[model samples]
Target: MSATTGAVLLYDGDCGFCTKSVAWLDQRNLLGFPARPWQSVPDHELPASPEALMTEVVLTRPGRRPLGGADAIAACVRESPSRLRFAGRLLALPGLRGLARAVYRLVARNRYRLPGSTAACRIERPG
Candidate 1:
């Protein structure tokens, strides 16, 4: 879909944990934007580079540069229902942003070890 329609969250389709995470959010109706696997989105439609997509989740919105990693998560939280908007704001705080990014990176690097994650969750970092 075009960015004009709304935001889209792109994640690694090959990763089991990532897939499950998206599905989990969908089940709760917390995802304000459509969630698509980066693999399925056409290259021309992708807002971020292939290496970036493989490393972290990305969010694209109309007339805005894509947000990746913790920033993307904060944006998603802001877009969710009103009841949860505060958490989004909290995540965006300068103090928490760095912590969030660090945590995101740590989890992303070892997602395969998390519960419900599978062998497919293992990913190689781009040099």
Candidate 2:
């Protein structure tokens, strides 16, 4: 995540996949997007319940409404520098946006099984 001001990206700190993903993006310096774990963010900083945040990554800008998951990523990429800006454009293309959302959901749902993730990353199904 970006360390500079402007937009913020919030992720699950306890999840290995989430943390690693954040770190990966952080190192890339994606247009100064401030990334932090929701666990450390103040309640007043969030637009919704922590549980809701836990379910998906969130992107928030000062005046705009908070966006979640793939939409959040798309918004962030759109604001990123030229090199990575193409990703945001791709997300906006017709038909691709829905595909991106579907892919994001699939990966999010199965993140626990991915490498680097631990049991803590597993989201249990509701009984």
Candidate 3:
């Protein structure tokens, strides 16, 4: 994909689960998409609140639109020509979309309780 088509994955830098997820994505070599931690995204540049970011995974597609939570994951899948991409498409279908979104929300809300999360993801307040 051209650099302009590249997607930016904004994740929680402090969460072990998030880190592991990023590592997994990296290993797949799924088009080698670049990822940036939410903490790394300059505060002045983000359109949404830091709290919003802490609550969802954000994916920004240059020259395109941004995706969050389940949509973001689907975007990642759609970017690659793999079985997962097909699965993502299936999940986007009407019947499955609700379930998929629900599951993503549940996991996102309880990420800290999951195996790799060290603590609940939180956004730092400006002093």
Evaluated with lDDT, which candidate comes out highest?
1
Better of 1 and 3 by lDDT: 1
> Candidate 2: which pairs clash?
1-26, 2-33
lDDT of 2 by residue, 7-74 (tens): 78888888999888878776785534677888877777676688887778988777788889988887
Q: What are the lDDT figures for the candidates, one per model?
A: 0.85, 0.80, 0.71
Q: At residue 83, what lDDT does model 2 achieve? A: 86
Model 3: CA > 4 A from native: 1-6, 30-32, 120-127
Best by TM-score: 1
RMSD of each: 1.8, 2.9, 4.2
Q: Name the lDDT value of residue 38 in candidate 3.
A: 78
Once fitted onto the true fold, the runs of candidate 1 whose alpha carbons sit more than 4 angstroms away are 2-5
Candidate 3 lDDT over residue span 16-120, tens digit each: 887787778667754234777778767876635778877777877777777788777766776665656676677678878778889988887778777777855
